[model samples]
Target chain A: MPEPLPDEGPPSDLVSDVFARDCTSRSAFEDVTAKWASLTLLALHEGGYRFNALRRRVEGVSEKMLSQTLQALERDGFLTREVVTAIPPRVEYALTPLGQRVAGRLRALADLLEEAAPEVERAREEHPGRAR
Target chain B: MPEPLPDEGPPSDLVSDVFARDCTSRSAFEDVTAKWASLTLLALHEGGYRFNALRRRVEGVSEKMLSQTLQALERDGFLTREVVTAIPPRVEYALTPLGQRVAGRLRALADLLEEAAPEVERAREEHPGRAR
Candidate 1:
């Protein structure tokens, strides 16, 4: 709640400064950058998917973890959960406009990391002593 | 270690496919997207900072966490640590070329989050039950 830059700009007061200890954006940052959150956002960015499909695409995400991740994304306005009352409750997850924008950036980062993975592997192999 | 896309293009074998359970890039993804790692990268992207200065800039990071984060980044080739054998043996952290590329993307994501933070706050307030 401490306004560091009072006269900065229009949204200065509500700005999400991760550097600020009390900034709500800190939680936002954590939520978006979390391991499952990143994968979930990337998967949703591709298209809407049912719970099981999403879980499959993400790979290795447990049922409970996926559920928690989706709920967090929904609460952040980055995802929408729709329930299609079928024989069994079929829930689908998709990204909102805001989520799309965020996911686009995340995808770019993911791509960069993917592209650089080779070099990173080399570095690890060369510096086996440093591998952790 | 499972080769999913054997017929893919060059570097496909080395690709950091996070979707792969045993991908080396999964560790890289985790390192770069980590909360302290993200902040540390952003901080170094600005300029080289001594250990104590970095701790101050990051805010709320413990001494141990900072050390561990630095080690991870360094091992991933995202950060270069130079030890200045002065009276107190000062160590400086800075971004390498790879680090710069990764940090640039992270900064963009951080900027996007900062811009969208107000809306996220509004969403949280509207759905107090969803706040977590």
Candidate 2:
């Protein structure tokens, strides 16, 4: 058998382990890049919005998933949520500056992806073996 | 209670649903950013590596998770795994050209993240409320 790979799992006590070996960065990347998360972050980063406005801006997102995504992002400190104690209890969500920074990076990635997506499609069409 | 966010879920028959809502993208993001996956992809993207070489390059990853990530990436058509019939069964892993493209985007993101990480830290330190 071949030799085993080095094993540096995430530090158990570090919250940022998500970015570390065994934590959730993998998952986080998946999350942040998702259609809704990306669009939502983009929308919010453009300007703070209330919950419904976010839904409208994102086009297609379920209440459960959006709530879940927002909660996760909030937990990760990517966005901030402020609940206004009103008769109807209004809540506003916006990117933290940290979130804004990440969103900027993600937006750049998205732009690049969008530009390359057509080429990727052509490549896949030309060489089926290159893509699934 | 406030009106809930809209409930647009994933399309039932879409393959790239990972990039859509209500699919594995959230989970996938969580996975890709996970320490091993990122490093592994980075290491592999730099060149190519065998299973053992990848293990060493990534630092810390369990055999199972690595296998899972490889399989997932392969299914998504990111990396290609080649098995050369040999004593003890030798397998090599390399990024597909498509993978190379994605990795380039990811690397750009990683670089941006690395640069912004310090700024984020300083911001958090300056304003405790901004971070978790």
Candidate 3:
């Protein structure tokens, strides 16, 4: 009877409000912020990578997880996956311009967290429940 | 006898490199980027909120998820929880200076996404898999 509901909320012209939970931006936000997705985006920001190489760059991500994350990022227009034809076909992933902008913000966040890691560790030590 | 293993990897004095699988900053980076944690931090950035208020502000967060997120943020020194004695005891949550700084970066990210939402929507529509 109705077009399949996309996730949640009534479709609105304004899809930019993430705090609303019903907005499409919220779904996009979740896609971007998903742990593996964020890391994959960051890894690709360095340059294009073939699938296995990208997975290696992210360290702990499994093949299945990295595949799914790349698919999702590609769907959201954050990246492009190209099939390079050679002796053997290879799939390479790279950030689109939009993705590069998004990765820049993520990089800033990562830089802050890296610099603050020691302070965070001190706080972890003082947490009431972390006595062990 | 040996000490307990954390979520993963070996302990290191250098905790700031998130790109390294063993660095503790990756764990902290995961903590900050987790969906609910990022939203909760942003909500608190506007001002403090009682637990219920925060749950409401975050839109769809379940009580249990909010509690866990708050606890983690508190442990990381990103926020504080205080009990106010009144007619009924109430707990309030607010970002610490550290959390404020983190939230500023997150806010910048959010702003970029919000502004870029239209283009992302266009990309989503044109994605090869979206022919449905």
Candidate 4:
């Protein structure tokens, strides 16, 4: 068998291990990777948006899901919620520097997948069990 | 307010829309971003691994979860499952080129979060409701 890659496993040098169940990073990472959460972060990457506007930008997210996602992203310091004093108080969400960085990485991943999706669709049609 | 980002909202330029609820890419992206699924892909990026060996590499995943993750990834054409006929059939899992590309993106994301975990931890400590 070929030799395993040099970075086969995470080097112990890093202080945090995301694969570890108890790592606090896992909590924040999950909140970011959660479907709605990542999409919300990406939406905010564009610019600030009021809650309903963000829902529209995200395409199909419901009010409650987007609300919870924003709260989680806010708690992780990925985004900020600012309430503008207005007729009913306009609440806008935008990415913080950390959130911007996170969104950048997510955007890259999303871009890659979106480009490869057609190939993946073809793969699905050929999937062995698809005929079963 | 600063001019909104030119790239705001998916640009309407990509061939596929990952944010759209019915998009095929959404299904594949969700599978990849799922916690255990992502960790498994990362582990295989090192090289091929048998089922139990992979379980150990991922640290905290249960066998059932790992099995399901592998199936999802395989179905999406991100990996290949091989059965080596030995005294007892040995099953090995490895990433296809597509899987490799996916893992590369995931590792970048994972590395970023790993580096940022301490900051996130500090944020968690300061989360508004932590005092409640």
Task: Evaluate all candidate structures by whole-model CA lDDT and list the values in order.
Answer: 0.85, 0.63, 0.86, 0.83
Every model's TM-score: 0.87, 0.58, 0.87, 0.85
- Chain B fold agreement for model 2, TM-score: 0.68
True C-alpha contacts between chains kept, each model in order: 0.72, 0.06, 0.74, 0.69
Q: What are the chain A TM-scores for all the models, listed individually?
A: 0.85, 0.70, 0.86, 0.84
Best by DockQ: 1
User: Per-residue lDDT of B1-132 in model 3, one digit per residue for the tens?
Assistant: 897778666565555777887665788888888979889988998999999999999999999999989998898889999999998999999999989999999888888888888888789898878431
**Candidate 3 lDDT (Cα, whole model)?**
0.86
Candidate 1 docks with a DockQ of: 0.64
Between candidates 3 and 4, the one scoring higher on lDDT is 3
Q: Which lDDT tens digits does candidate 4 get at residues B45-82?
A: 88999999999988888889998888888988999999
Task: Find the 10 residues in a row with the least total lDDT in model 2 chain B.
Answer: B16-25
In model 3, what is the error at residue B70, expressed in angstroms?
0.3
Interface RMSD of each: 1.4, 6.6, 1.0, 1.5
DockQ of each: 0.64, 0.09, 0.60, 0.51
Model 3's DockQ score: 0.60
Deviation in Å, model 1, residue B25 alpha carbon: 2.2
- Give the runs in model 4 whose Cα sits over 4 Å from its true position: A1-14, A130-132, B1-14, B130-132
Question: Model 2: DockQ against the native?
Answer: 0.09
In candidate 2, stretches whose alpha carbon ends up further than 4 angstroms from where it belongs are A1-46, A55-77, A82-89, A111-132, B1-39, B85-89, B122-132
